[model samples]
Target: MELELRHLKTIRTIAEAGSLTKAATALGLAQPALSAQLRRIERALGGALFERGRYGVRATALGELVLERARIVLPAVSELQREAARFARTRRDGLRLRLGGTHGPLLGALVDRLADAVPDTTVTTCTSWSERELAELLAEGRLDFALAGVCGSAAPPDAPQLVWEQIAVDPVFVMLPDGHPLARGREVDLTALADEEWACVPGDGCFGDCFTVACARAGFTPRRMYETDTASCVHLVQVGRAVGLCRATFPPTPGLTTRPLAGTPLVWRHLLGWHPAGQRAETAATVLAQARTAHAGAAARSDSYARWLARRAEPQTAVRRRAGLAS
Candidate 1:
């Protein structure tokens, strides 16, 4: 009978996703359920909102107008919620800083930074469902900061009114058993391992989706034998069960090694986001700096990764040296 914030969020999700199925996936709702909800919203609004098509869905004229209004209303409401959260209660030892991300190395670095900056305050990390969810937690004051790995330079998911900055661009690497044939090489070709069974995290989220897309581009679909987290994936690789995708920042694991994909230039860009309305901007800056420092430290600590960087730089250095000699 009446529209609510949930309805507004659904409208925005549909507009951005461009299809009922996709919007349902993003919102974690079944397709039929999302469609039913959309129908009700449309009925209440007195017109059709989206024009369904074979390829996808597009917003009708009425839908466009509603979305424009939703954008403005949602942020204001979120700001109000954020401000209200600040006044809930004053905690001793100042404010608690909640930091989180899936990157183990980055998380460790951030924890160290927080300890140094706010030794007496509470600091914690968590695994948020996704970047957008992490941003929501920040806006609601449930989370003070978040570190998420996003691929490419595409605009981040719509977490209205939060500040996001790219902290590090980590090169993607392939994890394999140390005794595997490809493990001896400095780098391995994706096509060379087309038939190899892969172990990757489940869900259409960042890690799995990126691995799938990359494999498909290489003219094969990775046979994911095990759907698990980084720890489990590493364990599987150690036993020679399957290979896994990895980032350079991950600490070295015994019986397992990582190599670059020879021709595929895959990467995960680390993003740090904070709630500006929560008045944690200064602290957020410190977190970002600490994360960058952590990334560098992680790379430095990994002998194989450090050597890879050095080998990559040698060609450039040699070219410069030759030029100097010529001059």
Candidate 2:
């Protein structure tokens, strides 16, 4: 029965709209519902907030006093929320960079770059295999940024409150034991390994479904697909129990060789996400640039990926040349 911020907001809306019907319309409430709510608010305050008139409505003396207080309190509370949001973005010691991500080489590289870029700021990271978990954390304000990947052209997490920016896109590759016959190939055909068991890290995205569709298009179903952690997936590949899927930029592992899938049946798009209303929005551009640089560094260090990039660009370059010749 006590006055609440929502009740205050209703009072203000009624005053601005100048009539109950108009206020109900503005607040998207049925007139009866709004009237009932106003009656409750008036009871809580022990007075009427408005006087009906031929023209519209006017505030009574007590209502005027309440209105004046609402005017002061609402704006002050709004400013308080804004200031608290700014303050909550940092830690007690100073500025802190909180990052959450799914297991990937890019997360480590991004951490390295962020540390170097902001030496005085404390950088912390949490890794979850679930992209949805990271998105939820970012929306809840627990993490300042989220680094995730989605299957080609698939939307990022379902969080509409967060803004997601593309950091890089890479063809998804397959990992094989060094002794495997396909290890020496520049690219392996999707159907070439149809009989091989597959292992992949579990994540919340359309990648699993996309993989199934890709395999179907390749004229075979993947055999015995296993969902496990990243390390376990690599171990499965190392022990030759299953082929592992990974980003093209996966660092070279001692017992395994990673190669792009021919025809690029699958692709990954790296994304950086954060709440746009958060203080981090101000520095999102800087963070995105650093993340891109880190991703480039990782891509550069992978010889196979570098060669793949070069080969992938040749078709575009040739098309441009053909167009120029035609002109």
- Estimate TM-scores for all models: 0.71, 0.73
lDDT (10s digit) by residue, model 1, range 1-327: 799999999999999998889999999999999999999999999999999999899889999999999999998997777678764523334767778675357787778866886687677778854677776677677877788767655565567677888887767788888899998998899988898888765432455666677778889987655877778888888988888877776787889888888764577788888767665456667778887877888888876678778988999999999999999
Clashes of 1: 0
Lowest lDDT sum, 10 consecutive residues, model 1, at: 86-95
Tell me how many clashing residue pairs each candidate has.
0, 0
- CA lDDT of 232 in candidate 2? 93
lDDT of 2 at 269: 97
